[model samples]
Target: MSVTDEPLLSVDGLQTSFYTEEGEVKAVNDVSYQIDRGERFAVVGESGAGKSVTSLSLMRLIDDPGRVKGGDVTFRSTSAVATLARKFPEGVATENSPGYIHVTELRSESGAVGSDPGATVRDNPTDVATSLHDGSLHIEAGHVDVLDASEDAMRELRGNEIAMIFQDPHTALNPVYTVGEQIAEAIRKHLEMDDGAAKERAIEMLERVGIPDAEERYSDYPHEFSGGMQQRAVIAIALSCDPALIVADEPTTALDVTIEAQILDLLKELSNEEDVAVQLITHDLGVVAELCDSVMVMYAGKPVERSSVEELYYEPKHPYTVGLMSSIPRIGDDRERLDTVPGTMPDLVQLPSGCSFHPRCPYAEDACLEHEPPLVDVETGEPVEDPDPAVHSAACLEYTGELQDGVDFDVQIREDAATDGGESV
Candidate 1:
């Protein structure tokens, strides 16, 4: 497969926990997914669902008391591949055509093949071997284990390859510095450009993110701008280095509806134009419906359901997912009260015995209280130990045929509601 065909990010069996005074709290548990290049993915759930924690873990920003205990986070590094080619040009040979190279052919002066001199190719074939394809110079380098990388390595990776858009713009931006200066600092530090060049790039970023009169706003402080403007500034900084993937943790929090819509649109536009992948974390299903191609519904630190936006909205399998969809306020619905999932999120430190969501799951039975159901394919009802990131799956006993009643829900998509911009559930 071409480099573009491989997943940009692969997270497997990710387990992040916090060493709290109360006890060890499992903030993120066995969460796994993948993000393809230029793909828009969403992580949706209520507060304390581990959505933010998961993002922080991926970014290696989890502070004191919290630890990413287990799992593998593999990321494709184009810069690493480029560095390899520069360091060992003799080892890289053209394969079929111009953008294709056989990395295994790399050999040192000693005629030894590998990343290091005097090492056989068999020693580190997969870890050091790179690939080129698609006629676009898309270098598919060996995967970098983010969790295992050193602090210095992480510093190099952050903001350059992977960037983050924090939840609150006010808190994210520094009050002491001009917003333009902050963006310029990141650009200069990563791209090694002079101050004037970085400033020009920063102004370009601000304008690209739709700031009005970008050149004039270059000197404006964070407090001088409105909430929406501050958010735009934050986005500009996040996009300053032209990162390959951006982990946006609720980019539209606390904004007015119009501003939120604009921010979402800007993200979509940038992702399309820049070919950057996006991993959006939000509690709002509306945002997911508006922007994301695929959705992973997390609950109490684990994904309970995973599918495309259309499939999840139209044919939900897990009861928790059903409850979430049911709770959305439909414009044409006549019900006085919107449906709500019963009970709050379980305490992470002392999560219940079997399934973490069994207490709140409407279809929970005795089996659910005794055994946690594995995530399984919705159609085949077979346990998926290693699920394809894009496939539809859910972690509920109903899929396993253990629940006697079997979970069922109807999604009524009104024919005329589409034209009127109304919703039905």
Candidate 2:
């Protein structure tokens, strides 16, 4: 499968929650998306918007207080398509003077564009064919229902087929083990290689990731490496098995600007070279525009908007998305005060009855405070409604028919002030 082909991973109606001592907190509510092979998809939001937790949920890595309460995640293996073209020798000089030689050459000499030469390609074409015969898989490219697989099934899919790089490299890397040993361990576990082979592969991966003296550095501890080097090592571990998909959660948060740019470039290069889909989770919309093909904007545990990188940065639809775009400082913008999205994020334990963002949105209406808005299609100035499903979908009452002309923010401020015991606004 190629990047232009249909998505290999699909998620639908994902609802994740945490059973905390305080109460159950719904972290992710009704999240859905599809990630095609070799695509760089991004999940962007403020803290507590469930971006990190969503990545964890996809890998079934949630533990302790957190659990995937509901939803489905389907993963398919993709590969390069190889078409065999056979050529026979025109005149046989040897043999019985009538011998035929079959010269099998790959079609499209530019390297079999859409073929799956890797074992990580999991989209079972055989199963698909059998299902078509007996009716099992039954789902079309875009219409496939998200799969509700068991833990064991998901475990088999994770790491080998899908791998995740956490936000903090310091914490993600094992301080006690040598960087080489850890990478080798991951390779051995996922690739099923012996210790020696895994070590060799680990050194290769280290060198591929631009580590200095890869062989010697393999025995180096995590603390011995700089922030950028640690990040590269983590990426090496993530790509050890050549996973079909990689979920990177804020991989550049701790690095300096120069290091951050390098890491981003490295990730982009790896994604292209390995032909692996990447799910980049971060709060930096700038990074999203730089790295992601499509972007999902989440707020208060729900996706407020989802659109392509250009559409999101240019013609943003959701109010929240617009606020975020405006919040980014431009080079020439010189105003006394920078615009900020008013009001703090709500308490997840006890969210508002209606639109969660209504309390903070400047354009929010009275109806927004009374009823929750359903994410739906809306006709704008154009004669025809936008058919791009991924363009823009917002959970805001303003998009709906119900509109309240003017609503005072005084009530909300008073309530918040009282909640904080008359603290300064």
Candidate 3:
């Protein structure tokens, strides 16, 4: 499917922090990216890179200590009318007006403009009100700034419009409830289907996710399913509501190689078949290569590199991204040990003075240690205040003409690159 004119999800200058007695740990700082409809975007980095925290902040799942300090997350919803009706029951009128009103024009009871019960969203006609029902207004589409949405509005959107597939299925799934019942519960709540209808839809979703004997497995609990099956069940629940975006946080991390491939294939198939956008968070570059079209490499809670998968793999601009690509094992490797990025991520509370990765960077220079670099366009080599998702950019002193001897790297291609030479990691 072609990408829509408007992006499905747009995040700008997102800053999330965790307050502790020691100090405030900036888990996600100035993270921004966009996901178009049916686009598969990958966020890859080492453990403390704020990949998961970024996703959590987007979902508004951050707790008290860990709050989203600043940022804007705008989402385009498919079922805006129903969601808004449920969110603002009092605003609904019995009068059947067959006129279209832009979502931004329809104010809540508090007279606040936007879909939120109390918050605000930008004025845009992307979402148009279609008609008014017995006690609800029907909207064809809508845009919502989730940050401004109230808790109740967020609850209506969470399972209904945006769904998350957590890393561990064991914790995501309710151990006491049957897998089918869990899926049915989400269908009933978000979809407003009856008991029988929800149960049938749940079984269908189970089958769609590749569960064997879904009918028989309906009554089975989480313990009854294997690791892979449990993960599939979680996927079924996430897909039950047909969310526009699915944030899969290391969905295959806990499964074995064989099962991991199955899960990856399933996700790829579902994303294409369902035409659902995906925000895949994983540390594995191999998985990113297989499933993602666009890639963002995050380091120290910031996007160090952003580009198409092919461009990122062939011509990585940032040293950190180059190091990550170099660490991946190739098909014909004779080295005793694989190359690894030196040193761990720095403490977020007290980051390095200049470039956070300067201490571990191989080509670091005096300029790199003295000044931080903004994301620069790869072609123009100019700094970008607000990056465009489609543009290839990297955060490196070399990009900004600060490094004396610039970072050097090359992608070697063998003569017989098709069969065995140009194998992806």
Candidate 4:
């Protein structure tokens, strides 16, 4: 699962919503995107723009009331799980080479053990301790609808294949467990590693993630470490199995700026060297510009613009996107005020009739308030071509010939407030 030129994961028509006492809040609507092997795809938006929810939805980690309304999250694999799974005999994970059995790969279909994707098990392999942490039960999900993948498959798939670096390390890392213990537990669960070996590997991973005094500090509780160190430890846990994809949801949220820079550097380095694709969910456009290869601008739970990082920054086509760009402070630039989108993001429960962003968009008109524009290429106003990395798509009425007064991208320097008041003596 190193580097390949194929799309490792594709999400289509994803709809996620939260049910409240008042009404259903659609957090993600018709979201679709894909990340190729080793690509760093970023999802950027304001606080409630559904960046985090989209990531959670991809991982099937969304909790109750926040159900996946409709979608397909297909994972492409080349029989890796099945191949390694064959090494297990009667559910007992073999002591020798089993490529990597992330979370007990209890055979999916025609359950059997062998070093082949087509190997059939004598029976549903659950009775094998590999099947359960218990002997009385069995678990398996019959489909790839990640939201509904069997509890066993998901448990293994999580840390084994797709791992997540959550926003807060404090809540993410168990307070009661020793830092090393948690990492070792994950390693043991996903890999065919014994206790002693798993502990050693955990220490190694901790060191690999740049934690200092790794061996000695393994016994320390989460509270014992500094903020940066805790975050490093969390990264260690996520990388324990060398997952193919990592969903980093504001991984730098709590850290100081310096620490945040270090974390981002580490993630970028890992993605480049290890060929691990990252789904970075963030509110910082600067971070997106710096770290992401491609960027998706989410607004009101829908993707309004998507393009390679360069196009998104310099050739932005969406009005909301342009406003966001004008908000970024430039070096050695003198401006009285930064551009801001007026009004707040809409309420998802009662999202505006047409385009949710119409209320805040400067270019919006009656058509924008009545008919929502689909995500289309800014130049052609057509569906985006998969191979065109330069395709800049935005959901804006201006591109669709519906916005009477389109966006004005001209530079308008306002008079300095104090200066406009009159000369002072």
RMSD of model 4 against the true structure? 8.7
Global lDDT scores for all candidate models: 0.80, 0.67, 0.80, 0.75
Each prediction's TM-score versus the true structure: 0.88, 0.76, 0.87, 0.82
Q: What lDDT, from 0 to 1, does candidate 4 have? A: 0.75
Tens-digit lDDT track for model 4 on 117-218? 212322333332324344422222111335545455667678878899999999999999999999999999888799999999999998987888899999
The weakest ten consecutive residues by lDDT in model 4 span 416-425
Error of 4 at 107 (Å): 17
* Range of the 10 consecutive residues with the lowest summed lDDT in candidate 2: 80-89
How many clashes (backbone N, Cα, C below 3 Å) per candidate? 1, 11, 1, 5
lDDT of 3 by residue, 261-344 (tens): 888888788779878899999999888878888989999999999999878877788989888877877766666787789999
Give candidate 4 regions above 4 Å deviation: 1-5, 79-145, 385-390, 411-425
Model 1: per-residue lDDT, tens digit, 1-425?
55566788888999999997899999999999999888899999999999999999988989989999999887765654443344344333343322211332343334434353213322333334334422212333344567765565567678988999989998999999999999999999888899999999999999988899999999999999999999989888889988889999999977999999999999898789878899999998889888998999999999999999888877887888878877888766789998899999999999998888999987778888888888999889887777476679999988888888877667777776644323455
